[model samples]
Target: MSEDENQISIAKIAKKSTPYSFTVNILAKLHRNSYLTTIHEKKSYVLGVKNIWNDHNGNHATLNIIGKAPLTPFNLDSDIFLASSEQIKNSLGLENNPEKAIHLGKIPNVDIIASPNIENFGRLFITGKSGSGKSYTVGVVIEELMKKQVPIVIIDRHGEYSSLKILEKENIPDNEDFFIKNDTEQKYLGGIIEFGDINMNPGADLGIEYLLAANVEDLIRSGSVIIINLRGLDIPVQENIVMTFCNRLYKASTLREIPPHFLFIDEAHLFAGKKKSDTVEILKLSAQEGRKFGHNLVIITQKPQLLDVIIRAQAGTWIIHKLTDLNDIKITCNSVEGLGYDADEEIQNLLPGEAIISGDLTPNYPLRVKIRKRYTVHGGAGYNVLDYITEGDTLPKSEIVEKLRRSLSHEILESASQEIISNQNLSISDLYHQIDALRQENQELKQEISDLKTNDKDKSLIPEGEMKEKIIDNLAELNSIPLEKINDKMMNLMEERDDAIINLKDFEKERNDAIFQKQSLELEMSGLKVENEGLKDILSKEKKRADDAVALAERAVAKLKKRK
Candidate 1:
């Protein structure tokens, strides 16, 4: 075809065939060296000069280029083969190393090789459903990288990677024999692999200074594999430790001139979830900026949808295994390129240990392949209840169990104590109400006593003339009563009335004193109420601490049981 014909616009292509089909067909024929570059609304092709080769007859011919202009579509084949080793080297800007490529696994008929370079650090992501060999694949990559003398740090959420310390043969369970060494022996690559367990129990020492004193950076610089076990830690504590460690590591990397280090976070969604957290923020920053500081992140998680978009976007290499959940599959497909309808079907049908590899680490395509075996032990296997029962083994040490029980007991006691305090507060409130009612009644009684005193005073102030007339009538009716006897009787009655008035005044004074005593008691109760509220606050804090302690202890117990 003429050069002009080769440069037809997308508008013209759509006239002859649908844009989607035409674009796919043209991309299928595009050479590896040719890239679709867009300028304005016109699509142009840039072919590598090196790709122009002379034939054996010394005759040179240009390869056929097919595509429409305006829109340069990417090849949509999900099962495209990877570029050769030399092509990969050139594409990734790496020196050609015949032995650097480690055999990852085989596809339908071809073996797949992956050579992870330092330049592409902090860009690998592996995800799969549980029991689909996610951890196992991580082990394979770690083993290969260790042989390459790359420093690695594993954030082992479930204490799985600790078995990296043991030889493969030693770590195999007694009830199962899965690995068999063949006659063709792989190279025995060794390095300094160490296990460090940070106890995250509530009272455990988690000071950042202690972490610095552990010489974590020195060990990593020496090419050691450090596995940080966070099995029994509370979620908050785990997040804190991971965040602190990453921050420290980032700061350290900035100061020291060290070899590139790889950080592998297994179950990474826990740390870099959609929710905002200190751990998530730190991990996002690390993923974006860690490359310049010689730090790389390899995040592994089963739930890709739960990870933050920014964190997922930073990954340049993605190894996706079988995922049954449609939402998860949709998320994985969206995150990656060259994966669509056919790829979706393939993902669902993928067997355990099989995955589709994509990203900058691979060629401009997705390669479906089975993951290779690990030289190290896979420590994150599911427990078999049958084995424990059939083996007739007793329970392991009960120290963790006992500690958990005690913690729960302590929490319960604190809760009960808080309840009691709450009840006392209620009682104090009721007492205040009662005292207020009593005060109201005392005021009413005082008014009634005042009314009685006024009536008594009015009765005592009756006219003397009327009193004399009444006495004279009584004396007349008797016709023989003496005036002196009458007068004496009137004086006795007046004296008795005055004495009664004095007694009523004394009773009013006593009632006033009783009201004063009640006011004092109410004041004391108010003070006690303030103290109770203070006690409640203190108890709330104590209860929270106890609850956290109990949660950690319970996790420890569960971990112990799983080990047994």
Candidate 2:
């Protein structure tokens, strides 16, 4: 092999480069959608592939600029070699191995680690057709993010992400069984926000506003995850819900009301598609400006073509899976900054669970990664109708009995408590009414007795004197018996009221204790947030010092070479 053989055309170099490697074409590619693969460099020494394209004066080749070794300007016909994998890793800052980098999966010889801190405010967009494992890839990313304790809120359009709370079961539950097969430890403090009566495990059904303002913010601030399940909702209602959430979140972020968090909207096309609506407008705005407020949006959809154009273009990271539609592929290629014709072709042939992660998330070049498996159960798995016909039931009778007993006990206790309170108040009111009626009867009896005595003294009814005395005596005996019975009943009622009052006081004390604990936790979270910000500032300063040192060394080397 002569040295002359190495000097080849730009197209030949791209063709001969290792499979799955990305290249930047310097000459303006005759495509309006050329902005698809642009990557902005953070380091000054790094060759920033500006979206600007030079005129095509026969500079048709692209250079695989991965290594840090600077090269002098060369003509299209000049000999240029591809960088080794090790050099590529070092140039992309992978050699230092930052602790916060998220492991996305692996490429050929290197693991793909994404540093969200290095990206454009953690905004990621994912797209693939159905069954292409886009959702699975999202789950993998979410699992990795969970390890870092990042607050995550997911707009689960199909109620699929609820499984993130539970560990994956060893066996699928029987079709007729309503309970999860295995009772495993919960992965996270996750909750589901729903409008309907259906409630899942590990979470209470919360309304949209209450979840957002009261529970969701608190939960996420405490590093918990929440899913806003919109299953069984009308399209318009779903859109309205998403709109309200996005608008409120953006406003909250702008006002610094909530801490930095990630919002994952699955099936985003339904809300912010090609249609020009409020959802599209707010989503587009959030994608563009939410980064400043630490509001990261991870938009997922099966159809990129249908998603809002502005939102798609604003994504800093893209995890692309197999896309058969030409328009979807075309949109992806155009939105991504550094993708070329070769990468576009690879997108079409990618296998399930395999994705091409490009944009700010990658290390200069696009990486084809085999997404790792989920740590939790995948709720979106396809259901088999035949499973219902099995003879044996997966759920044990004992477990069912225990579950029923617990549920019934809870309902009974709650009902009994309410009933007790109602009875106590009603009994007291009835006693007061009975006492008032008895007092009026006693007064009337006294007046009648006085009148009868007056008539006897006037000699108007001497013959009936004996009959009157008998009537008076009988009336007094009847009143005394009735009064004694009322007093006994009142005493019993007073005992019940005293007992209820004591119970109420105890319940209030418990509630106050819980509130105090909540306040303490919130204060601790605030302290942690302040500490985190301080550390981030220190890291930023250190990074600047390192960059300055590198710049100085490069200049010194250049001067030494000039003297030589």
Candidate 3:
């Protein structure tokens, strides 16, 4: 190779004289820990890859200055060379700058560990496509934190993290009942606090108001791994639960009611999106100022493009996985530091369980990490399709027949039974119980008044008559206003409850109708798929015939040419 081939000036590279491929090759050939010699404002300074970039205007190697860089008079155009180990040390101006780091995983094919600096672990934003192992990586992080005894509260939308209770994946039972019932029936690594029903798995048993009034403190005080499971609930109900939780947490943090802990929110884009909402407002406030109050947020989402701008900007760390969407990639590149347009290709090509770690966590440079395996079983690994193909052998034929009969007979009843047992129902029932007690008391009081009247008319009790009269007057005054008000309020609540029940029933009917239509559509789609295959066969035959005709014409043309 000629010396000139290896002797491209930084100025020429910056001015688009060097091709993009050549520039990439040069950088790739440089030592991993090497520093680039560049001049800014006539002052010589060594910069890292994060501070350098291949210009996007054309094939220029000009750096896209991110945080700090000279605007003009930067003249390090001389031939670029790799900085020695000593030179890199001197450039960084560090002797022994050491701190704690959280060991995440190792770089593929390298012994060097990929652990982020602990002190700068402020807020993390984790994003990836569905099934890209983003949640699995979160499990790995949580397990590490658990070892450190750092409190964690997860806003689990799909109830995937419950598997964290087990020490490791191998402890999972092999019984089908274990999977069916969603039970581990084994010792847990740490205490698991659940606010929702055990039967339902993931949902708010009571309304949002009830949770705020009751469970928020319990959630804050519990040092265990807390999971606010919101699976299987309606979107509005989920929003309400999250809104209430955020509001309480934000307010309490401001008052220093809770200690420093991690709050991992999955599907963060749903709560904090382009549209403004009460939930969004609280989340924004938390992202902006909650760090000061020790309320650290770990926002997780599959869609980075939809996440709030303010919240995205506040994240001190980013764990990006594979993303195919153009907008998602664009937003991720723009949001994260030490990344550029070139990084998009790497992101798109990232394998499952692999991620690019950037930002304050890894300040020196971005780390391409293969996420370590989880200690706990991954509940999010969806059911295998093969499992359904196997025939069931557990039940006798008679038992199976009985079960089928029962299911068929109770189909409508089972649908009704599926309604969530909400706190609203309990509250209405309690109100009625109170009203019934009040009525019984009123009847006893009336009977006593009648006896008192009879005794007063006969003069059998003289002194007691005046006292009885006073008591009667007091009772009348109390019943006259307060009792009437209570009755009116109870009646109003009952009417409202009735209306809500009616609306719920109508919604259920609509849902059932939709399900029926979906079933019908699926059957139609099956038929259409079979028909489509038949059509494809006929088209292939027609294409073969046409090819034969074209071949015959070509031969005929060759014969005519020879004759001429």
Question: Against the true structure, whose lDDT is highest?
Answer: 3
- Each prediction's RMSD to truth: 35.6, 25.7, 19.0
lDDT of 1 at 432: 91
lDDT accuracy of residue 163 in candidate 3: 61
lDDT of 1: 0.58
TM-score of each: 0.49, 0.52, 0.53
Tens-place lDDT per residue, model 3, 74-106, is: 432344543344444344322323335466776
Superposed Cα deviation of residue 486, candidate 1 (Å): 99
Candidate 2, 129: how far from true, in Å? Answer: 1.3
The TM-score that candidate 2 achieves is: 0.52
Candidate 1 has its poorest 10 consecutive residues by lDDT at 10-19
CA lDDT of each candidate? Answer: 0.58, 0.60, 0.63
